[model samples]
Target: MGWAVARFDFSWGDAEYHQETLENLKAAIKSTKKLCAVMLDTVGPELQVVNKSEKAITLKADDKVILTPNQGQEATSEVLPINFAGLSKAVKQGDTIFIGQYLFTGSETTSVWLEVDEVKSEDVVCVIKNSATLAGSLFTLHASQIHIDLPTLSNEDKQAIMTWGVQNKIDFISLSYTRHAEDVREAREFLSKLGDLSQTQIFAKIENVEGLTHFDEILQEADGIILSRGNLGIDLPPEKVFLFQKSAVYKCNMAGKPAVVTRVVDSMTDNLRPTRAEATDVANAVLDGCDAILLGAETLRGLYPIETISTIGKICAEAEKVSNQDQYFKKTVKYVGEPMSHLESIASSAVRAAIKVKATVIICFTSSGRAARLIAKYRPTMPVLSVVIPRLKTNQLKWSFTGAFEARQSLIVRGLFPLLADPRHPAESTNATNESVLKVALDHGKASGVIKSHDRVVVCQKVGDASVVKIIELED
Candidate 1:
């Protein structure tokens, strides 16, 4: 299903709560005989409105509001307590501050828009529009075309990653509200310092103008890219979010990184079915060649979680039917620099050989999961079985981290099925030969029912110091 990647959001709950939920989710996946990867989303830094009491405040259009910074009191209709020191610095007269989660497409009944009328030493006075109820909440603050001086990585975010992520060995860590390349760099560097527990991959979430401005540099540091259209709408004009998504996805493709689009099926959170617009949005994103579609509240707290997954999955499949992979492949390859690296050359050749032969599947053995990522960049129609051949950790216990972590990391890429090699299998002995390794991979395919007898499969592997692509028909 489109539920291959499961996200545990620190944005909503603490890591401890997420850990328990994760275990339960894993058990569910195990019971259903399904595969899913984990993505731990950092809460990052945010501005929120605090209230003196847990009660909703009624506000109408033309209502006067005062936004005070960090005074330790709850918000009222006349005064809103925002928990940020630099709020006044970024917001000024005539500036618009939108509240609520994903309020880009402001509904007359729900979205809250405020125009700053005056900036004072203690607070900023504003006027409200689009009549909506205000409440004691952790709402997102926005100042379009302006960069708020929020920390690149908040302490809470660091605590989550360094503690929960390291303990569980997360597959992907999506940096929230990433503003620049430095944000990604800092997170990765922190991860690396955690010794062998740093097997995680970082995905930069581009949601604002600052991130969009530094997209090139961020892409270089991030293992993948997440186009957060909801937040993008809040940062730019809602109508222009599509332009950002299209451009960002295309750029990620050319750069050979997986691009994941989020919030494509948000309406399913409360409704029994996705709206027609949401359905079309999913199809269009798939057609745009996104590697995956990420759901937020749809699966986190939505009532029709299963149905949403099923519906989006079907939409993605239908979109793929009419997609021009051949055209996309050419465009992707043409951007590669001359004298391609050894790994790139092998990856491109393998993809072309698979397509030309019309192979049923493409199987490759990878140590770092790089081979699978490169093949995914080519967007092959057939599934690519990326068998993760793990490395021996030098630690005292010698427990391998690459096998499972790398496998999970590869699953988010489109058309790639990452499977960890059965370390206990006799054929996977430390001193095994290439033939034995190939035998184990083929046996895995057979056991998983991915390959049938007499099926033609493309095999990409290394021989001594060189890589080769071979086409072979499985024997009965």
Candidate 2:
């Protein structure tokens, strides 16, 4: 079964080649059909130099900076700053910098363009080392960035992120530390202008009191919500975090949007194990009907990243066993009873017919996974096999339902053609070319091969310009 898991802290700096790492991650997701989206945290945008002294730094482009602090401290190395000067050889006022995997620009301030080449790597090592310590709390296993600020969101930054997301076929965009409804609107409009807002959803993080008050409005505009309880607890009374979490989850569920509960469920970033309280916290969040969960330091920089994911998965599975699945399913299913178009009506009818005929499998050929998803939305008892050409669609579908399966185009078309075309097929009448496809489906045990001569099978496909739904019977 395809299940969506979002990789929260997928850093390009940590990997050798950022683009290659992303491609490999995409490939892994495609193979497993499990990873729903890669939520890349814009490290530079969120990174701020809290303390900078008047020190000249002289370093050539691509030169490495190694910081060795005074008196028995560890040394850390950061890649030399990449700027317009390094890339294009000539720096400009509004040009952006693409260094390694990070992007910086002078749009926010001209001072950003000033070269600090004279400052030796060791002279400013104290500042660099201490900045890590200052930012350490935010990197903790349960830490969420609450009051963090981005230097600025320029059009170039927005377009860059959006283009990458669209090209990667990401299902959701999680705006870190979302504060207002306008922020949600701005993201929506940007994606809309890019003409890639169909199935791509935008999730807003509510991390403060002001965001909490306007949560409903934000939910109305956004596709989903993430409750960053750690930073949220900073603004409100610590004891109130649980209450606020419940409220956010309830609101998201009410609005039919997915909500993710994040924070230190396992305060074992440095340690190899989770505390008893952390286990309970994870179990409680699952009981609260969170569609997904996010792990920060635990999964990123933790000593036991794999273990953290496994433990959380176990807790969620166990909680789901005892939780009210029926209630959750009923609440989450959103169907517009009245079909708005011919294709939609046909899709809806095919699902009903499949259910009525007690089909063992609902096989669908789709380019976008839309038809299969629509059928899955009805919560049919049968498994749905979604055949598509795009690997991203296959991966994205994993989050939608547990019974959905995906097959490549070659497997669905070429490999199955002979079985589908056999004349003595019992799965359905061999009248149409696509009906033969059902023979291959039945041969593979996706559908029952032995059916009474009068038994009906519903076939749905888009032939040329028209979407057709035909009910066929077994040929004796």
Candidate 3:
């Protein structure tokens, strides 16, 4: 079955309560055999800062700030307490301090302005930088989304996000309301600078008209795209949004990039059940070749989060069974170009071989998940088992294909010995060859002691510079 991510949106206050909520949601989802990832929505550019001083004043790192207007506007700047001596140097006569994007200014009253020299202390009012704290909280929750608003992002904050992803080992970073190719490039460059681009994948959210126009360029840098229909619909006409959604999905498939269709798929965000239209919308997206679909309020803070996920899974599975996989393959295949690397060629060949032999399963041995990602780009029909030594690597494979199954390296080796011992197996065996690693995977779970002997399997592995594909038979 395909993997789906559960997205959560939070403000600053929700930070302390996130862990408990996450644990509850995780347990509920596990009961239904569904897996979910966390998406943390950071502060956006809705805040503005204002300075009330007649003379230019410098704000330092140390300041005790009280935000006066905190109802509608949220804080985006980090809060730092200031000592009396440092505060004296940072503020001048008739100076006001502003902290957030919402234009909140700290100004001395006219009466206070007259007595500036007599004032012993002053208050530096500013909005709090709650995005990072929220992210840090959700990181403890092990979320799937792990999203942050980029327009309001500072260089230092950007590095912090990348560092967090590397340290905690997050799978996907969703950029909110992305508009241009430069946005994607900047994010990629920042992650690369921090040595994190290889491990943490980026999912760019196309939420505006500009993002749609520059879709190709954006996709070139992004590992995946998220069709955030809610924001897109808000930005454009409804009819235009519909057309754009289809075009975007098609383009993403053509570019060999995974796209997730997200929004209020089910109007049941407040209710306990979804409407008929919601169900059809999800099914249609599945038929339209969406690699995955996202659940927003429906699975995040909705009343029936678990039920919503289960319903989505059921609908996607049914749609996939009847949907034309060949059509998707044919449409996407023409878009594939010359192989960029040896691993790319191997992955392409593996897909071609799967189709050639009508293989039931495609097994992959990977350390970095690159090998599996390349194969998934081809969108094969059979299930893909990504066998890795580290369990965390298996978690990272969630972004690639739907049917990723993880197996211990030792179990993989044990399952192959019997197949290598037997010569009468139906499929060709490459056990004697130096590329025996390929042979072991194809024969997994075929031995009598560890696994049932009557199982048949196919395995693919990267040997030397090429990915070797082999088929094997089991003996009892």
Candidate 4:
């Protein structure tokens, strides 16, 4: 994870600060001087407090409260309303509910706990188990050992995608609580309906048991995966999250898709330094070949956002130095079938050739960014320079966002430098001579200090129906 990824969780606060925070982060670059990727996290079927009274309700242990499945109801100690309409049916008697953040271990009051006492026709009776101040019109709810029956895309989620997400031209959208491939498809189809908005990549946030069960299909449909350990810990046994993350990441590595691991440094949200366990967690993710690591509360509401990023970034770099990428590549080859696809064959060759020749960089000219992504899957030591030419339909205008957006979307993938390029000479079709593409890629590499005179490089591109791979030495 060279550059950072900023994820906006829509479940907590109003949308007013989203645009401003987005602009600030878009302008902000990492120590590597690369722009970060922005991801919009939807407020998917999760339940929330609907304290319309705009006042905090103070609750003490053993206090009784009634939960109603109504929106915008005034909050009181006697009766509390949640945004979800199916609360009564979702939880049964004796079910435990945790409200707010996940920073608690034991005897901590980071969250308000409730126990369901009775389920009436339209209300749920509960008793507070701890003393905490409940915010007005805010706070997310999670029921232990219960699956909240809900759709993939909630009404609020759909509205956010079309309005805030589309208008902001975000680089990524992560569908929360993705149960299956169809759920991923539904989000993609909804974004596609917005026309140009479809440029954004959709990632599935695997949080629930259903999502973990159907990860294979979801992986195929999603552009990437976000291992939401924070939420998964709540949905499943805390111990199982560790195993699922490993399995999910290994699958993503073989598939050559970006996989992001989140909440690796949760303790850093409160402490300036990460706990020893947290530090090891960050290193293990990098050694496991995770494409990126996401910092949830560590950056969202942390005391030291900059320090937290620096700490994780340094850990990733150090771990990468000792990582056995060649072993991973060899393991991956065992999984690939005979007679590889054109893209896969060429990409694998590009990486191997780069390593064999001690190439300073690997360059790829792609229209869909597939070649670059595949090359990254091989985990070559050198970075991949991907010159992507965006494919536009007849009605769309030719502009920066077209090709640039596609390039930016590639930022999340490991070891890829995406650039939008126009061939020196072009015909009616988007395809250009290999020479023209090479010029743009080398020019970028040279300008970025990644290439210099006499440097060796591996180049790859599509030629007609086939693919081409070559090792070339740069000249003045």
Best by lDDT: 1
Error of 3 at 290 (Å): 0.8
Give the top-scoring candidate (TM-score): 1
TM-score of each: 0.94, 0.55, 0.62, 0.89
Estimate, for each residue in 148-176, the C-alpha lDDT of model 4 and write its tens digit.
78887998888887788878778889888
Q: Which is the better candidate, 1 or 2, if ranked by lDDT?
A: 1
Question: Positional deviation of 60 in candidate 1, in angstroms?
Answer: 0.7
Off by over 4 Å in 3: 1-14, 19-40, 46-167, 193-198, 337-341, 389-456, 474-476
lDDT of 1 by residue, 1-476 (tens): 45788888887767779889989978988898767888888767666676658687777899888888865766777887877878788877888887765323345555588898999896888899768875435556666667778776788888887788878777888898898888988888888898744778899988788899999999998989998877787778778889888989998888778999988776788888888998998999988889998887677778898898899889989999899988888877888867998888899899999899888889888878888889988998788999888766667756654477788888788888877775654223433655677777778788878788988899898766668799998888
The model with the greater TM-score, 1 or 3, is 1
Residue 281, model 1, lDDT: 89
lDDT of 4: 0.79
lDDT of 3 by residue, 398-465 (tens): 52321122221111111011111121221223334434444554445332123345544456665555
**lDDT (Cα) of model 3:** 0.51
lDDT against the true structure, per candidate, is 0.81, 0.50, 0.51, 0.79
Quote model 3's TM-score: 0.62
Worst 10 residues of 4 by lDDT: 101-110
Which clashing pairs does model 1 show? Answer: 51-74, 51-75, 52-74
